[model samples]
Every structure is written in structure tokens, then in C-alpha cells.
Target: MVQRHGDEQSHVMEREPLLSGTAQPDSDYHACHSISEEDTGNGVLKPVPEEDEEQSIGRGETESVKDNAHVNVLKIISVMLLGIFVAQCDGSILMATHAIIASEFNALKDSSWLIISFSLAGAATQTLYGKLSDIYGRKRMVIIAYTMFMVGCAIVGVGQTMWQVVLGRIVSGAGASGMSALVSVLITDLLPLREVAQWRAYVNLVATLGRSIGGPLGGWLADVIGWRWSFLGQVPPITLAIILCSAYLPSHTSTVDEQDAAATDLLKKSKFSRIDFKGAFLFAALVLAVLLPIELGGVSIPWSHPLIFTLLGASAILFALFVAVEKRQAEPILPLDIFHSKDAILSFFILGFQTAAQLGMMFSVPLYFQVTSNPRPSATVAGAHLVPAVVGNAIGGIISGSVIKRSGRYKSLVIWAVTCSSIGYLLLMLRWHGNTNWFESLYIFPGGFGMGVASSALFISLQMVIDPAHMAPAVSFMYLMQTVWMTIGLPAANAIMQTVLRRKLGVRLLELGYDSAEVAKIISDAVSDVDFIDGATEKVRNAVVKSYIDGLWWSHAFSFSCSIIALVLAVFLKQRRLDGHKSKP
Candidate 1:
């Protein structure tokens, strides 16, 4: 019995009806026949959200209900922007100020763990959180996640040493991971199909804004006061988010879409049903075993060392178990169906590599600066650099958001974004060679802008492809891959750069003119050389800079490749109008 909804009457099939708890059978979005609230459309049981009115041809005798839907979408966009900014800002700030952290902990020798632990924890839990978000409500899950992040930030702020900071970051990472998934899910929950990009643009811009602003802010705060304050800075945005969320985010249950609203829909009301927790465990274990070694390996011993191999072997076992269990389990954390979408799997792979390369650049650039300096910026001074990345990110966010708001589709923006990123990396490569100027960094802003566009486009893309039932899992899965890539890529970049520097710069040092045998003497003497001569040691300084520049070229190369791959992926995606009714243009 579908009770008619609202005061107005419209077309018979297109008539608005609230959920009245009737078991009226329909053949719609799902494979199984069941009664579900459906969109105004053909008699097929579509996914959870059946809001597509275009397909529902007869729905609007007058479009007042349709008008009301638009107003609600705008409200949802505003709420999502708040969450995106809070979470993005947190991730952006960490990279901006890692240099400051290393000095404080006195652990420059073994610093990857500081980065890895937080990343690993975040990656490990994201899938679980994604599933839980679907099981629980996205709004409630997000709020709880943010609170946990804030708690972690607070803990990091008060910590005395590396472990404390690492602990805080891990907690923060877990919370942040939860948001990464839910933010996308929320976009689907809130927007009409056509307006997904329009809605995402706002959140994407806010995220870019937070990152662009936060880098410098984190650096400035750490430079002026202390490194601990970088973590401390996170509290403001998170606290602001909590307050805004409480005020603006309306209550929403994690409603199951018609497609896989519950296992019963797909599997005839299974008497025995629970997600294969064991498989999820194995997956997390697999991620941990492989990732932990990759991140911590080169630091402890060579990459080919027995210890690293041992862990990798164990990881192989865990992954095998995860795959076997998932394939057999009635309900898998990873829906095998999703992988069947070649485009989705390929996109996930590309996106993961892109994340790794991006984060690796963020992780390495500061270290290049610090290692060369006899003494790096007092913790506070160096941290200030984070401000520029933050500002650029914010501006990029705004540009992408504003543009998408006007345009229904993000295809051109995706192409442009990737192109710009490619240019940024190429320019960054040049800057590393000898052109360390702010104008070179203009490339970075565009790169970030491209990232902003890509993030919006990618999030919407995943949403468009999957059944509404799988939306949360798909999002979380994307997140997990990204985290894994970042963990692997950052340290791997570090190892490669270090190895390259030893070969390129170490042997070449002072051989150009300054005495090779007397290099240290020359450096020491140069402190007083200004008194003895024309202060020609500027050449030495340039040489040192050149070394960093050369190493950073690898980052630029990787970024360029990632952007190229993204462009290639674009070719496979059929264009669609954001009008959201389905079937691509």
C-alpha cells in the first residue's frame, strides 16, 4: 500500500508517495523482485535513490515538488562543503609540516614510520568504515568520525615525542579515512543525479581552500611557535566542522537503496548473513603486512633484505586468504560485482597511483630543503611554507567548484585538470634543475586546481557507475587504495631519491671547481671565505640546490605520468549530462 505523499495530486505513476510500508511487488533496479520506493520511471527496480524525474515522464502536472527538490540539494551542498574542508585541511596540513615534526622528534633517520603509521591505520580501517557508513547513517558516521579525528589532533598537540605524535596521527588518520568515504556517499545522498558535480564542486573547492590555506598556516604556526602547534592548528577547523555539522546537517539514516537495501533483496532474505569479517580482517592484514615493510624497509636495511621479503611473503598469504574468503562469502566487504566493471577497477588503480605520487611529492619536497641546509628553518620558519600549498589548494578548489556549478558535466574540466597537472610537474622538474622561483610554483596552483577538478570528477564518476547499495563501499574502497598507494609511494620515492643523490651529487660534490678532497675544508673555510675572496661559494650553494632539484625531478616525472593516465582513463568514460536521470550522453 503506497500512501500518496503531499497535498498535491499529479500523474498516476509519477505521483509523489511517501514510504508507507507496503510490500507492493515491482520489477525495478534490483535483479530480485521486491516492493521498494521507486523513482517515477519504468517498472524496473532501480538502485536505492529513484529520484530521476526525467525518466518519470508523467510526474509533474506542475513542477512544485521538483522545485522543492532543488532547494534541498543546495542545503546539502553547504553541509558537505563543511565536512570536506575539515577533512581535506587535516590531510593537507600534515604534509606541509612534516619537516617540523622530524626535528622535534629527533628521528630524521627513521622518519617514515611517523608518516606510515598514520597512513597505514587510515587505510586499514577505511573499508570497514565505508561498510559501516552504509549500515549506519552517513551523517551520524561522519560526525562521529570527525570527533575522533579531533581527539587525535588534541593528543598529538600534547605529545612529548615521536610515538605520541604518531599515535595522534594514527587516530586522526582513521577518522579522516572515514570522512573520505562518507563525503562521496553524502554527495549521492543529497544531490539529484544531474546536480552531483554541482554539489561536489562546493566540497571540492572547500577542500582545496583548506589545503591551500592550511599548508602555509601550518608552516607559519610551527615556525612562529613550535611544531606541536601544527597538529594543534587542526583543532580549529575540526571544531568548526563539528559545530557546523551539528547545526546544518539534518538527520539522515543510512537508508538502503532499493538495489541492495539488504542482503534479503539479493539473496532471498538469508537466514544466515553477516559480512565476512574474517575476509575483511585478512584484507586489512594484507595491507598492513605489505605496506608496513615497504614503508619501513629501506630505513632498517636494504629493500631486498630478508626481513622485508619475509613480511612480503606473509602479506601474500593474507591477501590470498582475503580473496578466497571474499569470493565465497555471501556478503563480501569487497563486492566482486564492482570489480567486474573494468572501468571502475582500472580507475581505482589509476587513482591509487595518482594519490601515491601526489602524496610522495608532498612528503619529499620539504625534506629536500631541510637536508641541504646546514640547519633547517627553526621548526617554526620551515613550517610556514605549508601556507603556500594551502593557499594554492584553496584557490584551485574555488575555481573547480565555481566552474562546475555553472557546467553540468565535468569532462572538459577533467581533461584541463590533468593537462595542467602535467604542466605543473614538468615545470616543477625545471625548477628543480636551476629555476627555483615563485613563478615556477604557479604551476603548482594549476596542478592543485587540476586535482580539485579531478577529485570532483572522480568522486561523481564512482557514484554514477555503482548501484546505490554499493556506493559507500565503492567510495571507501577507492580511499583504501589511495592510502595504500600513498604509503608505498612516499617511502619508495624517498629511497630512490636518496640512492640517486648518493650517485649523482655525492660523487660530484666540489669536483666542478672546489677541491674534492678538501670539500669539507672548503665548506668550513667558506664560512670565512667571504673575508678571503669574492665570496665565490655561491657556486657551492648552487650545486647543493641542484642536487635537490635533480632528485625532485622524479616527483615531477611521476606526477606527469599520473596526469597522463587520468587523461587516458577519460577516453573510456562515456560523457553524461549531470541531469542525473541516467544513461550517458
Candidate 2:
């Protein structure tokens, strides 16, 4: 039960009794209450009068209202899941088709931008979506996100140039960021912390299904119809999701303190002024400056280029300015105060490192199979290999959710999650050499499983450690770190692969008595075209494959390092009680 006091700005959440009519101890609840008492000097819990409570519980009208509210919550969750499915499915489709689409326009070297542009745009706007939804209402934001995603899909379907497709991806990514962040926020709003893990497992299951189907489905569609059709096919589902959200989602704003409400009413004429546009702009600029340099440097341009230095310098300045601007705003896009907690800071970095490792592997593994497998599998065959990992991800989430729900503990799960991912990456680094067996490919399953478990444990732990008022911003912040790192990790892994492959392949060709010009040409063609190995001489093909294996070894090493770091950080996360009842202190 939650009670709102007009004078107190904080929320007091009570623990529900167990089924056996026994109350469980809740240390965090008592800690919060103690803090409230120390601050206000009169944090007293009020009990309802027995007669009044009986009358309220006895009313049939109240029971009917309760039933209606429960039904409405179910309706909201059902529609929201559809939207989550669309966003996740579309992302996986792009992952499968990105190389094929980029090659069509002979922009294979620039294919990383296909994903980077989307992530860049998403990371820039991710945190702002939370604050905007708080002011404008979640339903409106959902409709807007759905419309933008649909329009972006339409643009990509009809795009005539690679740049146009990239532009569409930017738009779609912005909408997808919101759809993903808001769903988690909404789930938190509707459920207690203990239950959040269980529901999140369902969300992960849906996401895994989308990813599992999307890879093969996208590849098949690209092979049968055109790659353009892959983008076009997503439009109808997103449109339906948009309509459902507009019709079924409630249009309620967040509850504010009475004094704050009064202040809002007074500023009704200038409500738009309250938005921290300066902070938002600075943050967007900072993200772009930071990511663009990372994505383009040492690939499109030399790392030592003047433009790279300029962008890095600008990013530093922008970061300082963004922090300053946010500190002054009453309703900042990101609540800087959330970082005050040790747990909040640790959770952000843990999420970043884990996501970077997981997504980096996802970006690389499909290409690894296509490049290294015997008989040279088609795109569809290559994509289908990820099914084991997806299934593992779903199973891991379910198990972690069940364990957390029953045991009311997550710290151990988090440690195990990172450990499993580290071992998975270690196997990849050690075992995935040229012409790997089909069974050996199952090495990625543990990594996927670990990520799935981390998703639930980390999110629930973050919620337990922060103030309830910071929930929305904190959730968005977590996603922002995730997207930012993903954007960096994918390209970094690719860059490592490219760097290693070029040097290794070029040297091998040179030692084989090939001319410098021929070696350069062969290396260029091999990296840019996956089909090059199929058409090359046997000796050249072997060399190219060996170089790719060496590069992948380094990439997997990077992921393993990240996972190990996350595991170390997980050890320091302070455990909190899941149940809401006061402890027996």
C-alpha cells in the first residue's frame, strides 16, 4: 500500500502481508522511514480507523472500481508488450540485413554507420524522453514514438541511397530508445521491486523471441524479396501499436507535492519554459561529439586527424556545460542527484561494461560464422546459428526471475551472470578458430544467458537503492549508458578486427611473394566483401580466413576483459532487502 501525504514530498510504501498472515522484515523500508524521521522530525505512520476501513472494504462500488483498475492495468501491459515487440524485432531485422543493404550501395566500409547512427541518435535523446513523459504524459509519448518509428521505416523502405537509409535509422533509433526505456519505467510504476524482476523476465522473453525470429526472418526476406521489403514489412505492425497506445493507454501525469502543484499552476502560462532545453542540447551535442569521433576515427579517417582532436575537445567542453546547466534546473532532463549513491554509480558502470561486451559479440558472431564456416553459409544460415544464444537468454532470464522472486536475493545472481559471460567470451577467444564445428558455436549461449540474468538483477538492484522519485530518470540513465557503450563497443570491436586483419593478411601475402599492390588490393576486397573469400584462390582464401580468426580472437578478448571488470564491480554492490516490511532492528 502507498499513501501520499500532502505536506511530505516523499512516498511511503508498506509491505503486504505474506499468504500465511506473517510479515517479512524489510530493512530498506525501515531505513527510509528512519531517514524521514531524522529529516522532518515527525515521520509518523497513520493507521485507518477500524469502522471506516470496514465501511470502505464493504462497498461494492469500491470493489468494482478495483476490478476495473486491474483490467485497465492488464490492457495497458498487453498493448505495451506489442510495442516492445515491434521495437525489438525491428532492431534485430536491421542487424541481420545491415551488411546486405550496405553492400547494395557499395558502402560496405561504412556499414557500421548503419547501426552507429541509430545508436547515436538514441543515446542523445534517451534521458530526455523520461523527463518529457513526466510532464506531458506517457500515452502521448508512446504515440509519438510509434509514429516516428513507422515513418522512419517507411523512409528506409523507399531510400535510394545509403545516406538516406542511415538517416531513416537515426529517426527510428530515437523512437526505439523511448519505446524501450518507457516500457521498463511503466513496468516499475505498476509493480513492486520484487515483482519487477518476474515481469522483466517476461519482457526479456518477448525480446528474445523477437530477436530469435527476426534474424532468420530478416535474412529470408532479404533473400526472397528485397532487403527494402524488410523495412517496409514493419510498418503495419507499428501502425497498429500506435493506434492501440493512443486508445488504451491512460493519460495521467506523475503525482507532485501540493506546493509543487501550486507552483506548476502558477507557471501554467510558461510551462514550456520549465523544460531544460539548454541541458538537452548540450547533452545531445556531447554524445554526438564523443561518438562521431569514436566511430569514424581510425576507420574513415586517421585517428590522429585534426577533426578527431577537435571533436574530442568539444566533447569535453560540452560535458562540463551540460553538467552546469543540469545543476541549475528545477526539473533537469537527468537528475544528477541520483549519482550520489554508491550503488547508483556502480550500477551504471556495471550496465555499461556488460552491454558493451554482449552487443559487441552479437555484432561479430554472425559475421564470424559467415566468414569462417566450411561450405560458406548463406546469410540466413549464418543468422540461424544465433538461435541457441537467444534461447539461452530467455531461459536465463526466467531462472533469474524465479530465483529472485523466491529467494528475494539478487547479488549472487549478478556475480554469476558476469562470471558466465566471462567464461563464454573466454571460450570464444580460445576455441573459435578457422572452420569451427557446429557444436562449438554454442559457446555464445553462456554470454547471452549471462546478459539476460544481469538485465533483471541489475535493474531490480538499482531500483532498490535509489529514491522512488528518481525512478524515471534513473531508468533512462541506465539505458543511456547502455546505448552509449554499445555504440562504442560495436565499432571498437570492428576496428580491432579490421586493424588486425589488415596487418596480418597483408604480411602473409607479402611473405607468399605477392607484390605490395596485390596484397593491398586483396586485403581491401576481402574486408569489404564477404563473398570475396568464395571467389579467391585457395591460398588467398586460407590466408584471409586465418587473418579473420586472429582478428576475432582479439575482439573476443576485449569482450572477456569487459565481462571480468563487470564481475569485479558486481562484488561491491550493497545488497538490499526485497520485501517492504520493516526489519526487526
Cα lDDT listed for each candidate: 0.60, 0.76
Candidate 1 per-residue lDDT, tens place, 433-528, comes to 542445553455656556656666666566555655555678789878777777777776766665554445554565775465566554444322
TM-scores of all candidate predictions against the true structure: 0.74, 0.84
lDDT at 220, model 2? 86
Q: Compared to the true structure, candidate 1 yields what TM-score?
A: 0.74
> How accurate locally is residue 98 in candidate 1, as Cα lDDT from 0 to 100?
75
